[model samples]
Target: MSHPPMRRPPIFPITEAQLVSLFMQSFAFGVHALVFAVCMHRWFCRFQIAGLGTKSWPWMVVATSLFILGGVDVSLNLYDNIIAFVFFKRPGGADLQFETISNWINIVRSVLYFLVAMLSDAALIYRCWIVYAHWKPRWAVIVLPTLLWLGAIVCATVDVYYVSTLHKLATIPHEKTLRPYLFATYLMSLLLNFLVTGLIVYRMRALSKQTSSFIRQQRWNRLKTVSRIFMESALMYTLSVVISAVMEMISNDAFYGTTDVSVELAGIAFDLIIIRLWTENTREESRTITESFIMEPPPARPRLNSLGHYQLRFPPPPSRVSFAHSERGSVHTNISKVRRI
Candidate 1:
């Protein structure tokens, strides 16, 4: 996916374009690998914080699955490197043609890449549902995203079926069959990110509007960090997918190879956000715990007795008698209100 096949590398000497493309692949893969490690570490920290009993278990699963997919991509890259070096770059290599570049592993790698994207998007949709849970007619807000998720799944299934059964190398199941799948997957993913982030912002805004006290306002201010992270991450990932799709569409004809790694950016986007979230969330939690401990109420002390014995003490001598008058000069004295004079 990183390399576009508009022009082939030289048989005698590699062209500047080839070098650049190679560099791009290496750089993109490096970024992908680095982010994958970060995501795993950060998600594991979150897992520890969330515990098995909480709602974070599913998130951990999704993150781990994405990490696994990254590993698979690395493995595929390793094989691709071996093939490219052995079969493509050799002085008297095999024909510089389709069989030389394409392989069945490409199918596996592409499908897995798409699978990770689907998983990431699915998690975002789940987040949207969680955010909008208080909305009446719950189905109204979720139905569209739910349907979109289903469409993505159907597209993925078709992609897997077509890609997995490929007989020719460097080939796909007709564009008509593949376009809908790729289009739906990427488009839905972007929409899901936007929708989820929007819902979260709405909730935050609602809370801000309802906040009355200074303390609550401070809490909302702290939460603004969380909201900022959500917005930036969602926009980042959505934009990455859009750029990747656009580059692919444009480069399919020209094969610039510079921005072909945008697919890898998708995974990188999630890792960065999740890491920031884990960091910010933990910081907020620790702050709350510290505040609670500091503001805790003091313990009540027991009353003391007097007269050199264990007798309850009464301080006042009851010098003033109390009276209640109901719209009359005549006083209505209450004995219960009078103290010992």
Candidate 2:
């Protein structure tokens, strides 16, 4: 009798969702690289212009950390993808690999994301504090956001603990033990963003109103522009988090894509604020130099009168005063004074 034909081993196929996630991640990585390059260039330019004495060291540190972590996170992700798709000889394919929640790569990626979120939130909170530094009871203004940030830290810690302890075959989007903490972490971050953004916008509007009568129209416009930039950046970051949170809730593979994008978006958002402010400051300095050259009165010189005696000349009286707000929220008044002869 002829022997039964040998049965082929079953092949596990990757799903459309996984493919979509991979594509989106690749796209996001490319975009993130471009944005990161631009941001770094801007940051270096600012560093050169301002030197080491500026108060921007904290931001520089945060930006650098994000860049390094982002690179590592993406590198690990690519390695995981390669191992799963190219070299793995397992019966189950990439789908099983991607679904494994307790994988070391997955856990490390999650931790990197948590760190990014925390850094971004902390930077936003610091910005809020700087903006309200002049207010009475300044600490009171940031109390809520600070507490929420702490709560996020706790939730993330718990979630990571649970994730690390999961079984080898455990799947994501179905881990009940980790779900609540994950939800809480994202929710806390979302709420913190909203509250901080609102406080900052409110403070800016108040400053605008209080200075409306005395502040020049040009200065007022600049303040408004800064406020708008702050709002737009915050909104971009907030929307990214919102999308990622929604995807996570629905157990969509897009959550991986969006979450990765959000990590880069956080740095991008923070960098945008600094870039805009630095650009504006550069432009303002150039304009001021040009105006000084054009509008500066000639120096008073001693001249001989008809009486054959030297007479003293006096410069014109001061006509206007300008108020400039420093990065630290201090207001400076610049007044032109007549020279005494």
Each candidate structure's TM-score, on Cα atoms with residue i matched to residue i, is 0.67, 0.83
Q: Give the TM-score of candidate 2.
A: 0.83
Q: For candidate 2, write residues 144-253 as lDDT tens digits.
A: 99999999999999888878787556445545677788889989999999999888778766666655666567655666777788899899989988898787687555
Can you give the lDDT of residue 205 in candidate 2? Answer: 69
Off by over 4 Å in 1: 1-54, 88-102, 159-181, 212-215, 251-263, 296-341
Supply candidate 2's per-residue lDDT for 48: 68
CA-RMSD of model 2: 7.2
Off by over 4 Å in 2: 1-19, 47-53, 168-170, 298-318, 322-341
Task: List clashing residue pairs in candidate 1.
Answer: none
Error of 1 at 107 (Å): 1.2
> CA lDDT of 52 in candidate 1?
24
lDDT of 1 at 171: 23
RMSD of each: 13.6, 7.2
In candidate 1, what residue range of length 10 has the lowest lDDT sum? 332-341
